[model samples]
Target: MYHSSTFFDLLLLASATVILSLLIFLNYIRASRSKPSLPPGPRGYPFIGNVFDMPSCREWETFTEWGRRYGPITYINLAGEPFVILNSLDTTLNMLDAKSSIYSDRPTFPMLGETMGWDRGLVLSHYGERFRSFRRLLHRFMGTRAAVSQHHDVITRETHRFLVRLLASPGNLSSICGGAVVLDLVYGYKVKDHNDELVHIAEVASLEFSCAATPGAFLVDSLPFLRHFPEWFPGTGWKKLGREWRADTYKVVDTPFDYVQQRRVGFTAIEEGMSEHDADILKWAAVSIYFGEWRGSDTMVSSTSTFILAMTLYPDVMKKAQAELDAVVGSHKLPTFENSDRLPYLHALLKEVLRWAPVTPFGGHHRLMQDDIQDGHLIPEGTAVIVNMWGLLHDENIYSRPMVFDPERMHLADASLFMYIAMILAVFDITKAVDDCGRIIETKAEFTSGLVSHPAPFRCSIKPRSLEAVSLIREANLMEG
Candidate 1:
């Protein structure tokens, strides 16, 4: 009986040991499965990473190639900071729009934000209560309903002036019209020439800001602690440049806004109640509206120029759009905002222009607010995420003949472009030039490469489509009088 009992005790000990081992193995398997790996990317050097890979101009093309090589989502490290370049529209919607809560945060720029005080603007503000408030206030003033109803008269009048100016001297109509519209809307101030005092000041500030804002443009952005260093410190020339930019920035941000406040043309959020020196960040929201025009107006300018280039390059598309305008608006009068719904082709042309030559090609990079996993790949917090707006728009599968400019894709749209383009086309017929032999000279519609892309200055013939179209202009002017 003693031998039998000892045998049973050993059997029980062995069974317990087996159960413990099995449990440990199961836990290890679970942990391994739960952990995610980082997405694939090119290997970087020891310290300085993919810095040399980025070109100051047309970095979008390089990013596109990386996407093709490393898959839809490509990862790269710029120095110590990691970046995840999203290459596809599906990923853009899924990551940026769907999971925006984790991705909406803006990256901190030491030079532009702290040293230059540029972070106060809505475009660059951090995703927080302050940015939210700034956005909300802008919605109140410049919302679709308010903008159309409140500023319709001014826009219409300025547009008429632009058409007349094109009639007189058609060169650079895009720049002239854009400056006129924004100047009136922002300050109720009139602008006639590119060298107008207000326009000149705004242009200077914009150039300085663009130069300083380029990634890795100034060492201070990378080494933020350098901003705390004295202005007289060796190799601190960036500080002086920042001061000059600030002065120019204030000229546009304050000058026009002050005039509008004095004239009571529109709502003034700053003069309404908020104190500039208030501890709350929301105090700076109103001024952001003023500074926002630094890029906003230029977007319109670039977009219009692109459309002109497209007209010059693709005469068939231009004539088709013009035919639509002739039928809908007629040669009797210019196109108006009310006629936008009927001019589908013209609307498509505008959409095509924006897609063909995006104003903000790379778009502002978003900083990840928290750690996230996408497609079983780890994206840690503080990773700078580039949406690659241009890359996504130019996807060949989505946009057939993606590089080719076609307007049919944006089917359902507004009539704003219809009015703008129709009037321009009605007044001036765009065509290529002819040599002495009368052979049509092939025009190359090249574009500028920078933060904003515009057509490189190219010569094109701008003549009135018909004598009746010119007569309509005269009658329209008399009617306005």
Candidate 2:
């Protein structure tokens, strides 16, 4: 009886041991599965990955360093979340254009996507038939040769009017230029000064919205658990801000839309063509109707910022350009599209400004739908592929003295031929401008934590090289009218 009892005890012990071993094995497998196959990157702490390692300012420099350290394709962890960056131009092109089918989808960030509900914006929409529909419409309105030709007069007229404003008050050049363009694009009207109610509303609404929607600007994006917290909680500042932003956004959109709707009802004071209305107004109408929401403040802000920056920073380039204009266009006539082909320097200047400090510093984020080997690295599916515009723009191998702000490089012999090279661009800046901010504020500047980076509040001053040049541009504009 004693022998039999001992045998039974040994058998039970063996069974228990096997069960424990199996449990351990299963746990290991689960852990392995959770570990993503990500590229080499800086080690992160308990929750935040590499965020502490990065500098508050000079984000682009950090990105460039990471690219150098971890190859062209590098992975960054944001609060233990993995985000991949495409640092080189070739990699960016390959992901965005070559594999566009898979890479066109945007990263999922709650503030920019869910709260603001911008997964529907043409710039933020996923890669699908719906996105294609919006893109096609945008192309029809802004990209088509016929469409561009139709609005040529207005673009020139408005831009020239902006120049006049610069002449009047260079300090308000940024506000005046941006305000004028948006006014012409949206309402087919012009605000001669900075204090116009519509301009104030549009600018403030746009900037505020952008700040609130920036992905990492608020703590709620990093610690999503805070979202479940009560709105009254201090930690829920982002949530409260988001709610306020949403209302402001509605005000921005509805006010303009209602104004236009009222005019469409009976007002015949303005021209019927798009040349008279803001391009953004049309965009808002089209998007709101199609997607059941409107989020495009960022795009407007980017374009507006670009024009203002060019006016302020490109004075030297503009002076040199006027020399070209004087020789080809002469002082009596303002520069026109007809004279565009003749003035290569001005064209180069425009291109350089777009490249110098891209309004969208990070080109765009693309999603990888399938596992693939690129540049010998295993890029796993569901990764957010970010293209670093600053890196490409500042690549030493591609551009000589990349930081010198030299527009003249664009006109150097065979520069056009070199444009096809990996780090260069042609006429237009390909980066996307997204309205992720909940309600863009009218402050002329705000920082948002997102894939796209932009300039902060800046003052743009415009001064003519010669009084003769100013007279000539005005005369040319009058003749066209």
Candidate 3:
């Protein structure tokens, strides 16, 4: 009161001291409260989090190892983000299925979503009305029963086309087969020329996109603030590549859409109810448009590559498969869906391929819709969840010698009897099994994130179960027509 300046200075000092005391007290309280027992994981450095660590290759292996050391539910921090990896099948069942309502949504990766146009892809869509609509459409188009009923003739014809292409030039077999199937499915056109412009663009665009998407490839994704810079800015290669990819992608997408539109116009004379095939094509086109606009066409392109790659890497699996085809099909004909029932080995082999390397090694990342608790841990809302399909497929309990490419694990003698005898010939011959089936090789991720993760162009040799399998393929080709 005697001196106003002295009083003001004393008040300011008191305020500062109180604020400091409160902060220290809060920190002490936080430390003393039984800290949330997060599942065991490698300790992270302060502030930067786990960004400076976590190896790319064998990440799945490391996660599985941690699960063994810790528990089914585990967590990891990457760039200040928490990733709850469900290690056990039971945990996945509990979270993805039991708590699916809370966990089905895909995490928002600003760089991948807005920058790369993934906000539209099927695999990345959140759990909402639009996602439901797309899933319904896919169900109608490609679900087991629906796909079988609707696309039997088309798929069968395509498979025959695949066999013929392989027989003609096995070296270009992958490109040819993938090109033919994807073109017919998406574009309503067959890839006649090996170097067709559409096919070339499709392959290049898909490959580039995949490369851009691999985890840790783009720093902007981890440090999103970097994306604020202009496209021409230095170190922003992703922006430039993304634009290039979008342009090429649009070309592939638009070509198909335009062709279908033209095709529809040509049949304008037919009454709407008169042509089922026309209506189906129209519906298929709409579905493709919805998927393309939302999810991008890269997954279809990538899956197409996956089908071909599986055959290339697992030659022993395919060789045994061909041997089964030799006995059952007897060199007289190409395998058809009609023979699929008899081709149990081929059927099992297909499932094995999907399981063995799971096109999406780390199941697409999912986002928590709201805060929830599971197994004495807090699953904070918006926590990134990785399905860890790699762990599920390689689980010891699920598959004997999970690492081995033994199609016979899924074999059923009675199941094969209904189709070609060739299906059974090789799987039953256990001696044909390769001693070292080896581990799956990881490929770079694409801009799309989840879909089209191929095994980055690797080589593996094929040895037919015996001379008979090769002879059968040769003889079948020779006898045809």
Top-scoring candidate (TM-score): 1
lDDT per residue for candidate 1 within 1-481, as digits (tens), equals 9999999999999999999999999998998888997778878776657666655767678778888898888887776777889888888788899998988888887667655767777767889887777777667656566454676666667666666767777664544446555567655677764457777776666566666656667776555557688889975788887776777666766776676666866444245565764323433444454345333456666777777778888989988888898898887777877777788888788788878878767777689999989988999899888867678889987899888888878764323344567678777788876778988877776765555666777766778877887887777766656
Task: Give the TM-scores of the predictions, in the order they appear.
Answer: 0.85, 0.73, 0.71
Q: How accurate is candidate 3 locally (lDDT)?
A: 0.57
lDDT of 3 by residue, 1-481 (tens): 6699899999999999999999999998998675566666777888656666555555676667877877787777776777787778888888888988888898766555666665555546678876776666555645455453454554445444444454455444253333444456545665564557766666665565555455556667566666788877876778877776667656654555566566653211234565665444344334343333222344433444444455554557756676777777665444555666666666676566556666566666788899877887777887888767778888998888887656676643211111222322331132212236665444232212333455455433323344564554555445532
| Rank list by lDDT | 1, 3, 2
- Descending-TM-score candidate ranking: 1, 2, 3
Question: Which ranges in model 1 have alpha carbons more than 4 Å from their true place?
Answer: 1-34, 145-149, 173-175, 222-236, 269-295, 412-418, 434-441, 474-481
Assess candidate 1 and give its lDDT: 0.71
Lowest summed lDDT window (length 10), candidate 2: 419-428
Model 3 CA lDDT for position 249: 52
Highest lDDT among the candidates is held by which one? 1
Residue 65 in candidate 1 has what lDDT?
86
lDDT of each: 0.71, 0.56, 0.57
Query: Which stretches of candidate 2 lie above 4 Å from their native place?
Result: 1-36, 51-56, 192-194, 213-215, 265-319, 370-372, 411-467, 473-481
